[model samples]
Target: MKEGIHPNYREVCFVDLSNGFKFVTRSCANTKEMIEMEDGRKLPLFKLDTSSESHPFYTGTQKSVDTMGGRVEKFRNRFARSVK
Candidate 1:
C-alpha cells in the first residue's frame, strides 16, 4: 500500500496481430501505441503476435504427436523386437 512506488496500472487495449482481434484489460505493460475503442475512448495499445484467439493450441488446430500415428508406432515396433 505504498504511494509513488508502483507502476501505473490502467486499462489497455490488446490487439492480436494475426487475427486482428482487439480486447481491453487492465495491465501494467508499457506501450507506445494508442487505439480508439468503439466507445470513442482512446487507450494504450499493446500488440501481440499470438493470442488465445489465434493460437493453434487454443483453437484446436495443433496436431498431436500421438494422433499422427507414425512416430510412436515406429518407436514401439523397434522396442518390441528388443524386448522379445
Candidate 2:
C-alpha cells in the first residue's frame, strides 16, 4: 500500500532459450534483449532454461526414480545389515 517504494511491474516476455518459446507476463526483472512479439510491441525478452512448457513437473514429463529397484534395495539391505 506504499507509494514509490516498489519495483516496476510491467508486462515482460519470457523466452525459453532452449526451445524458442515466448510468453508474456508481468515481471520486475531486468533484461538487455528486446524482441517484437506478435502483438507488434517490443517487450523485454528474458531468456530462461526452464518454463512451464518445458519443465518436468509442470509438463508431467518428470523422470521417475527407481526407488524399488536393484541398487536402492541393495543399499537398504546393506543398511539394515549394518544396523543389526
Instruction: Tell me the alpha-carbon RMSD of every candidate.
Output: 3.2, 3.2
| Deviation of model 2 at 72, angstroms | 7.3
Backbone clashes (count) for model 2: 0
- Which runs in model 1 stand beyond 4 Å of their true positions? 68-84
Residue pairs with clashing backbones, model 1: none
Cα-lDDT of candidate 2: 0.87
lDDT of 2 by residue, 1-84 (tens): 899999999889998887788889999998888989887999998899978888889888898776567886778977986775
Q: Which candidate is the best by TM-score?
A: 1
User: How far off is residue 32 in model 2, in Å?
Assistant: 0.9
Candidate 2 scores a C-alpha RMSD against the true structure in Å of 3.2
**TM-score for all models, in order of appearance:** 0.76, 0.76
